[model samples]
Target: MIGFVILAIIALGGGIGVIVARQPVHSALFLIMNILALAIFYILLSAEFLAAAQVIVYAGAIMVLFLFVVTLLTAGKDDREPKENLAGQRLTAGILAVLVGGGLAVVGVLYPSRAIGLGLPHNFGNLRGMGVTLWGPDFIYLAAVALMLLTAAVGVLVLNRPRRQVKPAPRLEERES
Candidate 1:
């Protein structure tokens, strides 16, 4: 219980840090920390496969890709872009935030407290169970997700590829000079 509490606090802190970080790289690192904490939670819940997947797919691949994108975009320095001046933007944002928060609070107040039940069978989190699910009717969805990721990675590579600048042949007079 204490460990869970500690992990939850760390996760929450990481989430907040991700939002509050000024640098994109710092935010990505904080996001990685959050992903790791979630993986730990999965392990604590006896979902070892999910824990491993979370670490490998999210913390490892996705975070690395995000950091690469951040570095590529910023070139390791803050690009001080001018802030946009939209009139009443902050006021509008504050109004939306208050509305969302108030709605959530109202829902919480109305919701009844009950002992939540685990909805899975005993072998739910095991490797075999995951395999059955992944290879079963859901295989097409998984394949589609994998394809999408591959496409995005390819897109990033294409975007970052150096273009071959075709320099016009020097004028004959300039060559002579």
Candidate 2:
């Protein structure tokens, strides 16, 4: 219960930060907070490996990349201009939120007493077990995921970096004459 409350608070705070912060970098940091909160929730659900992976991937690597981008870009220090075009998108977002909220409300009302399955042993969080699962049988999937992330990171770096121009050497004076 306490874990859930903490997660809820963190998530709410992160959401508020993301919306209220004017700087894109700050907003991205808030998103990192949200991802970390989710990782904690995964830990609470006894998914230690998943929680660690979430932190490493989302909070560490992805957020670092976001910071790199924020640094690389030339967004001004001033607060971002308010968007007049947001009204349409805001309405759509609000409608989607309502639909999701309504679904959750219905589920809570209909199955208030529903229980979830908690699988596995106490030692499931051990590194050995996780390693075995990752390398022993699911190696292909793991390799694929790693490859995808590497490709994406490389692609982003390549796309964002400034390109260099090759300058031609000047001809000798005699040759020109």
Candidate 3:
């Protein structure tokens, strides 16, 4: 319970940091923090499979892709102040935030203990069972997905790579000059 509260604070702080970060990379890093905290929460709830998936898929692969895209796309860009002409945007966001917070607060008040896994099936999130299934009849699908992810990562890298800009060899006349 104490650990959950600490993690909740960290997650909230990371969420705020992601929103308030000035740089896109910083925002991505903050989002990674928030994601990892959520994964830890899953671990605390004994959802090992979810925690592993969250860390490996979201924090590892997705975050890497996000950082790569953010850095590569924004490379050599001039920093300019954003033109915020959306009047009352902040006011509207604040009101929505307050409403959402109130709803959550009421839920928390109703379920103070926040019971988890009330009617879950046996071995519902067991990692061993998932591995057996994936490696048994689902190996082909897993291989396909892995190939897709590899191709995507390669494509993003290729897109962001600097072109060699090779120049034609100087002609004889130009070389003589």
What TM-score does structure 2 among the candidates reach?
0.64
Models 1 onward score TM values of: 0.64, 0.64, 0.64
Rank by lDDT, highest first.
3, 1, 2
Report the C-alpha displacement of residue 130, candidate 3, in angstroms: 4.2
Q: What is the Cα-based TM-score of model 3?
A: 0.64
Candidate 3 Cα errors over 4 Å, as ranges = 112-120, 129-177
Predicted structure with the largest lDDT when compared to the true one: 3
- lDDT winner, 2 or 3: 3
**Off by more than 4 A, model 2:** 75-79, 82-88, 105-115, 157-177
TM-score for candidate 1, residues paired by index? 0.64
Which residue pairs overlap in candidate 1's backbone? none
In terms of lDDT, the poorest run of 10 residues in model 1 is 112-121
lDDT of 2 at 54: 93
Error of 1 at 88 (Å): 5.2
Candidate 1 per-residue C-alpha lDDT over 1-177 given as tens digits, one digit per residue, 9 for 90 to 100: 799879978998898799778888889999998999999999988899999999999999988899889988888575565687697886798699779978986896689446336366757788998889889979999999999999999999999999899887778557743
lDDT of 2 by residue, 26-133 (tens): 899999989999989888877888899999998999899988898778466556676684568877986998899789978977886535654575457667777888
